[model samples]
Target: MTLGNRKKNAVKAATAAKVDALLVTHLPDVRYVSGFTGSNAALVLTGNRAVLFTDGRYTAQAKAEAAGTRVVIEKKPAVTAACEWIERAGIQRCGFDAAHTTVAALEAMRKAVTSKVRRSLFHPVGALVAALREVKDADEISRMRVAAALGCSLFDQMLSIIEPGMTEIAVAAELEHQARLAGAEGMSFDTIVASGERSALPHGHATTAKLPRQGFVTLDFGVILDGYCSDMTRTVHMGNALPGEHEAYDAVLEAQEAAVAVVAPGVTAGDVDEAARSVLRRAKLDRFFTHSTGHGVGLEIHEGPRLAAKQTQPLAEGMVITIEPGIYIPGRFGLRIEDMVLVTATGGEVLTPSPKAWIQL
Candidate 1:
């Protein structure tokens, strides 16, 4: 769906939620609704009307991107400008993102308003958008599929170039660069380049750690193309691998596949997670499992309807999420395999398009 349609959904949500107007101040949320990709912007959604506000820096962009929505250039903070509109429009309750806006910003906004309109720190309008975003339309699914194809091939490209002496940071930079070269808008998150003992950290930063001669190197990466994102993880051996390393990698991959096989609409997020964790548990590697099975992915890297224990949401058709199962052993090394999966009417569709087998390069 286009930004105009997203705005319409927001307006519909505002009316249902009893909100006079949703003052969305989160940059991603603003972009999601109005296509106004600015560092600072806010979206105001009335029942059937919407307006986008941004400062002078993005005045031109706002005008260009914010079609089917009203655009206003702000001279100061967006909340300040929103206050002006609320007073003039006689809005009694203006919704705000308490999760994104600071307490000081809210207080300042209250003081700025005419005391006629009530300022409420409602949960972000993005939360509503997030729920909507979970189920991808045909166009969104297509973008993610392209991202998946590029990401899958791009990974093989990076794997073919790994050398014994390359630093983790260098590999990460090269991976991102190639992703951009291969049509990736950007990376969804910091590309993980963990080697040797550093691999024990699930979300390890790309550091100066050089590739080990024969241990595990976990490369968790994602690609953003056409506004959608793709995620994949592959653990490889820098050289001929060791037995324990191979075994660990094998278990993780098997567990990931086990989960992937059972993903479908009408399943609970917890059930999907269990499908994988049970495999690890059977292998007696459950202790090393430090995180949830995976998470939802869409406009933002980590979206809603998480696949984890006690996740109260159900998997639905058109919902795209990740199936990353890992085993991290502190002080030694870690093994993880992640891939993007789109829940379909039939079953789950893999979006990463990468091979999960342990490859030695």
Candidate 2:
């Protein structure tokens, strides 16, 4: 959606929440509404006015990047400027994202205004713009598709370079270099290159550990492109895999695919999680499957509508999420198969449709 539409939606939400204005201090929220991708920014939204506040450092940048919004460059902190502006505009009940705002930050915001308005001026609004951002627009989906494609191509390149003796950090460095050459703004998160027993750690980042001659190498990474993020994980065997290892990989792949198949409009996020968990449960690997099945992805790597047990949020079209399932057997082996799936009207479409077939090198 256009920036104007986003601001309009935020205003409508603020109105519904019984607030006259919204003070957005979160950088991502500010970017979502005002199109300002600066490091320091605060966006104040009302029914009729949308103003972006930033420091003097972003004077020209804010004006050029923030479209269809009023840009106010101030010498003071952006949040302080935004709060003062709200008080001057006669806004009494301004909403702030309490989830993102800390106690000290709130105190500073309240201190920016007069004592008469400080006590009752700011209302707690939880993730107003972030909730709106959960559903990707056509433009956002297009950008995410490109990011996912770039991740898949990087994985393809890594397959040829991975060997038994390569250090995990070296592997990650090469992958990151390739991503930069391919035009990624940055990585979504620190690259994960868990080899052999290290694969048991779900978030094991790239270290100096060397790849084993015959064990699983889990590669979990993502790339940032055009202000969007893409996440996917694939585990490959270095040399030869035992029969049990092959079975475990098969089970995880099946579980990941099962979860991807259930993604569609009107489906509950819990149902999607169960679709994957049930597969692993049948394989007697449920205990090894840790973490949620997936989460909404867009401007941020992790968003709302999380796919996990007892989560009642329903999936909607235009939401992109990851379907990742794995079994990590500590001190033995582990493998994860993931795909960036876009929720569609009919079902789900895999954005990262690289080869998931068994790859032994």
Candidate 3:
């Protein structure tokens, strides 16, 4: 979508929130509205205009990137300048995202205006821009598809060289190196290379420990490309898998796929979680299956419409999420399988089409 259309939507949200203007201080929100990817920026949206305030560092960058919006280069803090502009505009109450605004930042913003206006202005509005960003546009989905495809290619390359006795950190380094060569802007998050017992830790990062001769190694990672993110996880056996290990991997894989199957437009997020949890529960592995089934992925690695138990949010078309189900047996073995699925009108489309079948090296 064009920046102009996005700003128009933000103005509608501001009006719905009963505010005269919106002082967007969150960097991501600012980028979403103004297309300004600078480090420091604040977007002010009124009924009739959208203005972006930044420092001298981004004067040229803002002019080039932030199209269809008024750009203002100021010496003061972007948020402070934005609040000052709001006060000068004769706005009685302006809204700011409470989730992204800290107490100190709020105080700084209030200080930029008169004491009387400060007390009444800057209302704490919750996730106004984020709510709008939950559903992706066609262009956004296309960008994310490219990012997901890159992640799948990286996973395939890692499989060719991964072997027993290699340190988990070594594997992570190779994966990251390949990602850069593949044109990834950066990793979506830390490159996870949990091996053997360490795999039992849901978020165990790469360490110096060597891969086990006979156990599971979970590689969970993602890449950022052109500003969007893609996430996927795969677990492979080192030398040989035990009988129980095979069964556990099968259970988790089934769970992950089951969740992805139900990702249609109109299904509640909770229902998707249950689809996965029910499989593990039936297999008697539910207790070991920790963490949510999945979460929405987009401009940020993790965003809205989380696929967890009791989340009432329904899936919408153009929403991309990860369906990851895992089982960790402490001190024994751990395995997980994850895929990025895009919610569609008829069903779900698995974006990360990497093979999830049993892989024994």
Candidate 4:
């Protein structure tokens, strides 16, 4: 969707919420509405007006990117300027995203407005823009597809260089360096390179620990391409697998694929999560399966529509989410299989078209 249409939709939402205006301080929301990708920005959206406030540094950029929106360059903080503008515009109430705003920031914004309108004017609102962003448009899905494809290519390259003696940190560095060379703006998050016993750590960051001669190495990573993010996890054996390791990997793979297969429009997030958890439960490894099945991935690494127990949110078409299932047994071995799936009307389409079968190096 176009930036103007996005702003229109946001304004409609604000009107429905009984808000005269919306003070968009979150950078992503600012970008979504005004198409301004600057570091500092504040956008105020009213029924018929969309004004973007930024510092002097981004005057030209704001004008160039944020078409159909009034751009104002202020010497003070953009958000403070936006609040002052909202008060001056005689808006009765302006809603702000409570999820991203802190107490200190809210206080600052309130101080920017006059005492009469400070308390009542700055209303706190939930994830209004974020909810709209959860459903990806065709353009967003196209960008995310490229990002996921890049992640798959990085994994393929890493498979060739991975060895028994390489330190986990070194392996992570190699992947990141190659990612930059391959045109990634940055890694979505810290590149995970857990080896052997470390594989059991759900978020085990890359460390100096060397890869074991004959154990599992779980690599969980994502890359930022364009403005979207891609995430996936793959675990590979170094030399020979232990007796239970093969069975454990199979269980996780089946669970992950099962969850991915169940991703379709109108499916409840909890049901998709159950599809994965059920596989592990049948194998009696549910206790080892930690963390939720997956979460929405897009402009942000972790977004809404959380796929976990009791999540009643239904999956919508054009939503992209990850289906990652793992069995992490402490001190023995841990393995995860992840895929980025796009929810479709019929069934889900796997964006990460990489090999998930057992890979032993």
Maximum-lDDT candidate? 2
- Runs in model 3 deviating more than 4 A are none
Q: Which pairs in model 1 have colliding backbones?
A: none
Q: Which ranges of candidate 2 are over 4 A from the true structure?
A: none
lDDT of 1 by residue, 1-361 (tens): 8777788887787767777778877777777788877788777888766877778988788898888889888787787787777667767666666666787877877777765444443333435665677788888888888888887887888878888789999999999999888878899888998998899999998998888787888888888887778888888887786668787788888899999999999989999899999999999998999999998887788987788987768899999889999998888889889888999999998877677776887
C-alpha lDDT (0 to 100) for residue 173 of candidate 1? 92
Local accuracy of candidate 3 as per-residue lDDT tens digits, 316-350: 98889999999988988888899999988899999
Model 3: what TM-score?
0.99
Candidate 4 per-residue lDDT over residues 244-355, each given as its tens digit: 8988898888999889888888999999999999999999999999899999998899998899998999999999999998888888878888889999889899999899
Put down candidate 2 lDDT per residue, 131-203, tens digits, no spaces: 9998899999999999999999999999999998999999999999999999999999999999999999989
**In order, what lDDT does every prediction score?**
0.82, 0.93, 0.91, 0.92
Task: For candidate 4, list the clashing residue pairs, or say none.
Answer: none
**lDDT of candidate 2 vs native?**
0.93
Better of 1 and 2 by lDDT: 2
